[model samples]
Target: MASSLTKDSVHPGTPGTEKTFFGHPRGLATLFMTEMWERFSYYGMRALLPLYLVAPGGLHLTAGTATAIYSVYLSLVYLLTLPGGWVADRLLGPRKTVTVAGLIIMLGHLCLALPAAASFYVGLVLVAVGSGLLKANISTMVGHLYNGPKDARRDGGFTLFYIGINLGAFVAPLVIGTIGENVNWHFGFALAALGMALGLAQYLLGGRHLSEQSAVVPTPMTAQEKATTLRKGLIWLAIAVVFYGLVGFTGHFTLNWALIPLTLIGLIVPILVISRILRDKDLDGEERSKVRAYIWFFVAAAVFWMIYDQGGSTLSLFADASAKNTIFGWNFPVSWYQSVNPVMIMALAPVFAWLWLWLNRSGREPSTIVKFSSGLVLVGASFFLFLAPLSIAQDGHKAAAMWLVGIYFFQTVGELTLSPVGLSVTTKMAPKKYASQMMGVWFLAVTAGDSITALLSNPAIGGVNLDKMGFVALESVLAVLAGVAVWMYRGKVNKLMGDVR
Candidate 1:
């Protein structure tokens, strides 16, 4: 039986490692709230970004310019996880690293509050790097809260963790974005900073529970461990700073520029090569097999996010352009419609949690990989469901609100299938020594898929035909590709995973 948070909730047979929070670890709730606030800041800022820049006399950028900046910011935010993962694994543990990152992010939000073109670049840089560190590592710590050999409870914990994410997301646009829209744009940024401050406080308050876990397993060093860590830290910082400066400057001027490709090649490719090298260079039996499964899961999740992340890019635009919604006898900001997915996730998660446990009682539950592949198909299927309205409409008129809601519903379910599971898979399968590294790779897939979404929305290529069946056509093709990828690799992938069920 698990212990309670007020007292240490230690697992049976694991002494000294008492669980800390509501039937979970003491630190779990702390991290949960931290993530909640961080996400609140992120999604809140996201709600106002293009609207702030492109709406009326804001920045007055053309659609292409706005989308370019949006996509670049999105891509960089995910891409920096490579360094973030490296820093946590090699130098700082997840806990402290996230501490530094939260500060950076808070500073970034402050920059956004500054009324200058230069503030845009500085604020985004802080946000991208700060998010890169916090995103992968905080999720990893939730796994540590469960200490057992291949502990099955981990996924449920992560799903719960994700619920915190959606909760913050649900409120962010309504609260911060709404304030930014009606009160002041800078106030929205200040709100984001305030949220980050709260996250840092929770993390600091809960540091005791996290001290036990190392973001990475230790490696032998010729010099002292602390010294070696410091050296690597400086090196990583220098590299990141150089790239940050370059990207910050280039992004302001060069569209179709080096930022995406350079960032991808500079950061992501090395991780890929390292993972492959690790796959072939070291391990022998099942360990190596798990490594291979890690690769497969990463590919599958990338495809999933490509479609899923539309919530920010295409879906954000859809809300602004298409959906019709009103609350309290007034039209809610169109962006707030984006809240429906997170809201659905928050409401549905407990039901799915119960459903999974009930199914397990019957000795029937889908494997994580199967769920992931199925998520792609299900989410992809939602496109057709949405396309139906546009297909049948007599003219190129906006589709009804039901269509957007239904699509978000399917996307939320699909996220439930794969996303939380993907995190557990990485933590379980990755080399104990390379946990954060694999997490970084997992994030890379997301960056890749999301970048493709950005590419799709590039107006030079013709903005997605939102009023027609065009968005549906694009996603349908991706779904087919995802299905094919799954068919070809499922056997190899499942075998590597051993008895995951």
Candidate 2:
């Protein structure tokens, strides 16, 4: 198996730049720091979004309404990932993509500083586009650090990257979320922009750390690349223009009403193309089967994110409304509860990493498919546990903060089982030609889950009580889906994983 191969790794500082750090490149530090700040900017904003929108000092949006906005934002963010990866893989490369995205996100944050409704909506769109450009590409650059596919450090590299994400998440809520909760909401947003600007500056200043992943992979006619690039650019421009125009028309920031369908189209077109890409005779059957399983991988991940993203959307609302959060007789802000999951993840990642290695050596680690199924069940069970307290906390009484902490605890454990494993699964399971694209697709499922969760969080959704519906609906749906998938594909999921174990 590719994962079975191992040796020293290298890191890239710039596209053509290469240097080694303990068998890897010094560039890893630069990229790692950059990703850390980027995540900080992103999560900092996420931790505050629902609160900002619903707070009286902010939008005064209802819990349901705020969640829908968040859902649309999440969906569009991942959907943009398709074009983001395509552009990076075929045009700009990872380093350049990261830089461009950083700048755009900074610009978005600056706009977010404004109090006008237009600025808030406009800022979020920019962030979404920027995230698409950055998220998957940066991780790919890490893979490029190793000269070979089977480098042992690959998982560690990803773990380092994951830490960067949580590192940002960890501190952002404390600073940005708290300020947004207490001060001018826009100030918190401005802080996020500042974080991105710093990340961009650090990345460019330390160009020596980047690897070869940024070099233009040689291609034929220049006009063809230009045409392909232009077509996609124009398509995105059209979507953006139409979307912004409606914000102008409505006096309300209702971008999702336009974005949701466009994103759906974006996701569908790629699945068809990815299928054709996998059929190339140059690929082997084992690779093809692995790729096929990735379809399920994407679907399975969708279920996971549906539960995972509630941290920002529904869970935030739950904290504000019903969570009984007090520590040593001190009451805490509801938004602070949002910080627990990342905290758990940050502390537990190393433990899980070691656990996986130990279990693998002992032949006790679950298969990838089995691990994912178990994760779904774990996450579903978390919801069921929450349900018990939820039923008791009705009538607008604030439930104890332990409820929120407990919710994050179980979900964090499930994420350990699934999210990280699923990410590695993408690289292991895809053809080289389609690795970036499949990663984008894997994220598309994330987008779908976020969007769906966001929509469900909306209080006015066809008269559905978001908190009432989301908790029960999420728990029931995921439980049934996980159970059925595990039962039905128990054999195939394992069979497709040829020698991966």
Candidate 3:
């Protein structure tokens, strides 16, 4: 979701000419703090969600239901980004959209802080909508702060911005997680609301430092197009309402059944989008070939996220119920484990960046496909690490905390290898006419993976048992799929990529 600004598109006062913040624009600081606090609120609530749902003092839901809800929420968050981006492009630009999004997110957290069941669900819906709107547009704004796409400082500035993200994520669980687990859960939610308030305050106060172009819609919809869009939206809304009414009338309306449509959307959208791209008469053979290659990468990324994102759901449950939460003679809350991945990212990101640079300089850097395959391998192997701990610790003894630490470390490496590279490749391989659509397709990889995770994690659907042996079998099958993907597609994908490497 990165954007490149032309000279005319960028505001003069905010581009590379400004050197107030670490030789970058002062706007970086503004955006840095804004995104930092946004992430703080996000990860803060996420760390507590699965555990909260199953806690006696909380909702006391079953693990399967909790994971199903978590996966569905995550899928919607990513899926709505498509429309979110459209909103920014066609109506309210990035700045206003971000402001509105932040306020909505704060309200969501406030709703969560209320002691009512209905409020809890309303809060989740609000937070998901707000996050969808805020996520990409804010990053787009950061890109506007640069001179253009080729600006040498662009990557460095983004790296610094990335640190802001991890810094917030790393600290959130320690503060909010500790409070939520030991104190009242509502208090922790209130803290998340406070974090968003702080972020919104700074964002508004520092608005002057941002580029004015951020408020300009890149492509305002024409009157005819707007009417057409509105018509289509109403039709979809009517369809959804009818479907809901039918389910209710039939007495088959349950949470699990309600989630099925989202899962289907996640699974089907990528296929339809890719098919449309491939069949576009405007695309030449070269463009179609590149897209064909991108399909493989997309599938690989989906599989990677399926395994990696379980850290919040399946792994969180494991930490709470199975992992020994003690180190140095002090027992810690389980949510602290949530911070490990971000902390690892902060430490390892620079190293990975340097490693890629060094390898490229020596002409030893792997192709994007190879790096993606490696990520799959690394993430898949990380799951196997659990088998060692599961093998021992008989008689209800919990596994050591270090075991989870090791797993997170490996997954972090895998993430560094694949995630950023995937984004870069998506932009490179996209047809010029459909560049933004392709980015949306990339996010669908996450949505699809999360949807599948939801189905598998639900015992009634996929019957994926939650026992140690069940986990072992599940991880083994997924790991084998990773291996099979590498074995089958590496050469074909490379050839299809043309000169993209």
Candidate 4:
């Protein structure tokens, strides 16, 4: 039987280890490069997928259908993290699981590189499953790189790591997206494969830098439990294979209908996971209270992402349809807008890092809930910026490229405020036994947000024919109101934290 998780069970980084990367642990570099390259592949592919769907000589799908697939793919990519985290926590260690996930992701990119439509569908499945495996566990490993309870450097380390992530995000669209958009789609996917391969190679070469504890599974299943788990996994694998086969062979499979099941999964999984954790007999009063606070954070994050993550779907469409592509007669790629986020992140992260340090030193740091509220307001404001001018743009006169840039700039600000904080807090609040799973729950909020974006992007779902700006305006208002409400309840939420913040 697996030992129950407790707060003390987490492995701390090697004490007195020489700081090789930015005065942080040597492992930080390993993870930093690994995540950077991973994001490059992931975001590069994302930048192309929607465009490919609507392009000639491609899937040639409608905007609604293409975005629905995009949304489902993104949702599944994060949703799978729950099981992926479970696998790492209970079966393979984070190190091994992440390695395997990297390999699968490489294969997924290769699948996309093939010219066949079937390859495209199969590739999406592989990437989504692989991403699910890698995302939560890799993040959890980052948390493991520091000593808990006394690690003042945890948030700063994640902020620095976030820069690496944005670096990849910044570069990928420029490189892979250019070739994908202008030259050939499969070729672009090929470049993404190359990126992942490089990342995997770097990870293998730099394994020694990582904390030794990451290699040890925290919870080990008993023989009986392992058998049951294996059986269930195989059955699900078989079902997935059958479903993929049906979709690949019979042209009757509809992505719109597919959303129904995904919606159910998105809705049910978090509830079950949260309930299981909260009802755990292992939790003390303080831990239970922390879990409640975490739930509130989860909701706030979902709301924020619902607005911010439009970059891939609705925002991408706007870039193509509404935004003027020419900058001083030099036409930029639609995908290039995707790079704006990473560029801003790269520019602003250090500033925010310094700001947080200053705030902490001055004893004026925003409470976690307060920061979350600020993020929500900023994301909402990004949408309103778009609505302000585009709402009045004369028909057929494309909005300026600066408008999209402005939106992404503010959205990046909101992301910096919430994303790193969300990762740091989840790690702090997680019950030791369920650490990886809790991280998965935090990502589940992203999954829910992505699902909502997908649904809203669908014309069949009343997302079409609506004045896009009006919708953005309404959503922006709602998000701002939601942020204010959370801020009002901040005291109650802080009480739930019990001095952790």
- Best candidate according to TM-score: 4
Model 3 off-target regions past 4 Å? 1-16, 20-28, 142-158, 206-216, 245-252, 281-286, 393-395, 465-467, 470-473, 480-491
Pairs clashing within candidate 1: 3-9, 9-19, 20-25, 20-26, 21-25, 21-26
Query: All candidates' lDDT scores?
Result: 0.72, 0.72, 0.79, 0.85
**Could you give candidate 3's per-residue lDDT for residues 1-501 as a string of tens digits?**
111221232334555343355546777778888988999999999999999999999999888878888888888777766667668878787789899999999999999999888899899989989988887677667767776544545545565677678889999999999999999898999999999999899889878878777788877889999999999999999998998899889998887776777777878877887898799999999999999988888888888888888888878887887778999979999999989999998898777666766687788978777788788888887778867666655457888999989988888888887876775666567676653446567777888888988877676576452436566557656854775686477888888988777
Q: Which segments of model 2 are wrong by more than 4 Å?
A: 1-26, 216-221, 228-256, 259-286, 455-463, 469-477, 480-484
Candidate 2 lDDT, tens digit per residue, 1-501?
111222344443223333343334556667767887888788888888888888888888777667777877888888878777777777776678778999999998888889987888899999999999887777776666654445555555566557667877888888888788777688889999989988888788866656655544422237777898689989999988997888778887554555446445544654665677677887788788877766776777777887777767777787777776679997766667767877888899878777776776787967677778877877787777677557767755667777768878988888887777776767667677665666677788777676666555444445244557455756656665775687479687667767664
TM-score of 1: 0.87
Model 4 quality (TM-score): 0.93
Q: What C-alpha lDDT, on a 0 to 100 scale, does residue 387 get in candidate 3? A: 71
Q: Count of backbone clashes for each model?
A: 6, 23, 0, 1
Superposition error at 321 for model 2 (Å): 1.8
Lowest summed lDDT window (length 10), candidate 4: 1-10
lDDT of 1 by residue, 263-352 (tens): 345335735655674656556677777776677777677778777776665556655655555544567776676688889999988777
